[model samples]
Target: MSGRLSGKRIIITGAIGNIGKEAVRSFVAEGARVVIGDIDEHAGRAVVAEFGGATHFVKVDVSSEASVASLLAQGVEWLNGLDVLAQNAGLQRSGPITGFSQTDWDALFAVNARAHFFGAKHAVAHLKRSGTGSIINMSSLAGKRGGPGLVAYSASKGAVVAFTTALAMELAPDNIRVNAICPGWVDTAFNQPAIDFMGGANVQQQKIAALVPLGRQARAAEIAPLFVYLASDESAYVTAQSFGIDGGVYNG
Candidate 1:
């Protein structure tokens, strides 16, 4: 690691899971001290232990605005301030529009879409104090191009893209950057919903081969670097962009 993030203080939500875990490792490796926020206390504590002193964990339910506010309050205090916020927590529910209950739809928006807003809403004060800061929201390729069975999930993630764009402009004057990462099929248990909707792992693989130009799913490690880049000063001039790491699924 080149210590690209040396002296940076970061807060990452969903740090117990695949992509979030990998991003935490990458951030720490690049020399950032991080506070992890998640709902699972057991897994969050284990991650803190795994990372030693460079990381701390704060229990949070991203879907709750109060929970998110508390997470940021505690996290910023722990880190002594804040420089980056990675809103990586999300929920996915897939089914036909007719069959998708309103309950699931609301749940999806609460976590996938509204959570980003909640996080940014609370994180802005701490970030502004840093003079320059970054916010990375995780969107998806489904958000960019709505798929057959992903109406709700896609709608929620699409909201993220719009949020990122508008927030970037609003925060740019504060030297705060906002961006979205729209990834395609990354190989993680996180994809189980889509896989089940596709029938099974085998069918998902077949579909990936047909849809992705790279003919495979990306690994979590492959996606973490993008998080690191956005969080670091390397992206000082980058903002308001929804970057696609979808293996050429959508060129636009």
Candidate 2:
């Protein structure tokens, strides 16, 4: 009956999304109290409400300093301290450079890249006070390799990976570990349009699954434990590294 995250207080940004929602469940099931922050108030409340009063939900636009500040404050107030900060909010858009609008690029980066920056910045204060906290940033495989239509997402994820390394080094002295998880081809509804446009449901899925040596996309639940490991003493000495939960796509 040992709980890996017993008594831990975690704040997961973008907690309303598919993978984020699943992570919430994992964190809770492992005995951690979670505070969720996301732009989707309805989904965020609904999801957290499913767990009832045990979890806290906040409306946060990670791109906004005030929103990030408010969310962190609420989390700190509710949990008394913070142990894990999972920066998991992001968005993806497709358009070639020649046809891509600069506005689109800015908008996407605000949520996908800049939001990570702000979330970590604000969460750091409470985490540092909690002593020996862990920071896990959500990255994507697109950041590792270039794709024709995925420039913005790829670049943003690349930025997140780099940020993880640099932050890890800077925060190591505080015993605060920082890491990144780059997920690949998750079979969630997030990419449904791309899958559907590419072909029928089964065919599209098969094609994507074929890319990974494992012959399938990932599940959010599958990725959550990595965060738990990174957040726990089991990985006490692990930091500044990026682990790919990408179905052997990166072969790491």
Candidate 3:
């Protein structure tokens, strides 16, 4: 909280959710002024009110290029510039591969994969000019390992990882760092829908104990510090990296 990200300007998409809210708070606590880009106007405004001076809210439908562009323009205006873009807006559609509808697949990619592209496309110019920009894409452990009925969701998250790596190389010359965080079974309301899709609360608990060596899902606060590390100059040399913050699940 003592100026790790002092004087930085950051934009965080999907800032109303369990994980995203924490990212917004963490960024603010570390001395960064943040623009929260989210579709939930109510929640966004609430966040702005709670954080006061250093935070602003802008409505963003990440699946739309126009919306993403508008968010960037408005955010830059509020912050006076940009330094970090955290692309955390995403959608999860779960179903067996054989039963996955084309509509669901398209929706998943539009929000999860295409949104990252839209964010980076609009933000790169400002970031490149800022000189030490960081782009943090929110992926999931499901991206690295397939889940039984999460084909579309997994595929979309996997695209985030691949996109992050490719964009890192492309942005290296501009000194903008790109990285992806693949979180595993975070204990947040954002994951309740996925848990229900998998089975239910009882089944999810069993899966956590059996599958995760840490024997529990992570809290939103637990996963947030990583965002601070990646966004701060502390990770100046880290780029093109896919970090797995999964309670030992990726290995165990």
Candidate 4:
């Protein structure tokens, strides 16, 4: 396919999620062997069916240390090696500082923040072996700014950004680059419920074109190529950076 990610073995967490599922398709089309890890058995199996044997599915909670460990072990086993790791699995629950439960706060940290670390930890050895590897973490603009209803999710994402930068330095000597993407509101199923909760009946939908100064919400396909770029040799010198694929929302 003359794709950037050709011949790479990729692992994507939350592979059943809207953006994640699209990523599995794109990465594979671009010549990567992908392993899907998600807690949703049915959804994971459905995705596996769509691609037949091209993908392997792992049932991972990603928040627990043991689950994270197991997922990585299995992911590497399935793919034979890890050339790229996309830590896109996460959960978002709406909450203000006060109404947020200990449960929700902890959950957010475990999935949205901790999973990235575990994924990176597991891939480090293989990445070093290849003499170069890339770690692409999925973040949100909410991490860079304040969002009243998503305190926990925002904080966890901010942690991801910091982690990505620090990791870039850790792996740079190995010729590996680490980066995160700060996507603006994207039209994905997981995020749609939040829009509905925010009193946006076609609200987030209509605002898509106006959300950013460039005038549009990012679609999954639009955001994916960047992931491929960062994970491939195309971004060899780019590391410790968080890119905003916001259509210009971050400009504000």
Candidate 5:
């Protein structure tokens, strides 16, 4: 509403999901033109329809470098430029380290960690041209403080934080800012993996109530504002930081 991101062009990977959808809405509301990239064409198009003319959709498989490259290319072409890239595509698998399969670990890293690298690698040139670019990678509080049955997921997200920090310093000279958002206990189906691992929805809620200082989980909308701020020029001086949007779940 404040048009904080007026005239900005943004690309959000995994834009069909809970947090991604909210980020798209928030970005569009703030006057940014956005490209919604996801693996699901049906959902991606629906998101574009919901946002009307301010958005476009691109089908992308973030695990593949070629797909990631194509998404950025198509997105930059649609917006005629690029200002922000939000790497929100990720997957979670929760289980004890003793029985965790190599397949699961590799899959988690492919999306949760490697995708961010792919996105950043392809987005740099266009972002440099924009002169005021920002990259927002979605990490998790588990990435900061590992949890039970979350070994693989935590490792992947932690990789995102490390990559974001290093990339920020590498690109700072180009005026490109890179940062990571580490959220905790967001109440969305996206947490179904961890929820099931904990037992069920009831158990997940109980744990959230006990663990988080705020005694609850965050809504996707509650997490979207940070995306808006990081994407806007308001965060021009902010880079190489991992911001925790958790309900006081992480003290570090």
Candidate 6:
């Protein structure tokens, strides 16, 4: 840990999720105080306990505006103020368009796309107060290039990309940097649902090997550093950008 984020205060939603858990570890190791916000109370508490200090867990259902607001309010109370917000809570429902139910579509967007907007809308004030703040939205490679069986999930993530771009311009004058990360195939349990939809774990990996130029999936640890960099002063000049960390899957 280089203390790159020393004295910073952060709130990471979906803290119990695969990618969110890695972000928590990376941020804390770099000396940031983080509030782990997630619906999974047990996992969130476990991370806080492991981190020992400078880490707090608050249960949050990002899909609700009230829940998002509460997370920010409680997080700010614990950390004194907010410096960064990682809108990482997301869900995916797979199926072809013809069979995609409205329930699935709404649920997917509620957490994936809608949550990003609410998370930022609630945190912007606290962020602006920091003088310079950062918001990292977790998108996906599926969003950039549509996935065959991920119609609902792909559309929801694509919404996040557009939301990030629009919100960046709106928040630029306040020194709040907004960026999105499009990850290809990161090894995490979160991929289990998609894998099951694609046939099975073996089939999924085979497909990834053929699709991803890297020929292998990335570990969660490999994706955590980008969150640190984007949230730290190291990327001060970087804003309004959608970074692809997808094993060379998306060139644009």
lDDT of 1 at 105: 97
Question: How far does residue 69 in candidate 3 sit from its true spot (Å)?
Answer: 0.5
lDDT of 3: 0.92
Q: What is the C-alpha lDDT of each candidate?
A: 0.95, 0.83, 0.92, 0.83, 0.94, 0.91
For model 5, residues 1-252, the per-residue Cα lDDT tens digits are 799999999999988889999999999999999999999999899999999999999999999999999999999999999999999998989999999999999999999999998999999999989887999999999889998999999999999999999999999999999999999988888899899989999998888888999999999999999999999988999999999989998886
Q: State the lDDT of candidate 3 residue by residue for 1-252, as single tens digits.
A: 488999999999988888999998899999999999999999899999998889999999999999999999999999999999999887877778898899999999999999999999999999977877999999999889988888888999999999999999999999999999999988877776678876898999999999999999899898889999999999999999989998898973
Model 4: runs farther than 4 Å from truth?
205-211
User: Model 1 over residues 29-86: C-alpha lDDT tens digits?
Assistant: 9999999999999999999999999999999999999999999999999999999999
Q: Model 1, 86: alpha-carbon shift in Å?
A: 0.3
* Candidate No. with top lDDT: 1
Where does model 6 exceed 4 Å of error?
none
Worst 10 residues of 4 by lDDT: 192-201
Q: TM-score of each candidate?
A: 0.99, 0.94, 0.98, 0.93, 0.99, 0.98
Q: Which stretches of model 3 miss by more than 4 angstroms?
A: none
Question: What is the RMSD of candidate 2?
Answer: 1.7
lDDT of 1 at 116: 97
- Pick out the ten consecutive residues of candidate 5 with the lowest summed lDDT: 202-211
* Candidate 2 lDDT tens digits, 59-178: 988889889989989988998899999998888776576877888788878887888788788888887787789999998887787566678768888998898999999889998999
Model 6, TM vs. native: 0.98
Candidate 3 all-Cα RMSD = 1.0
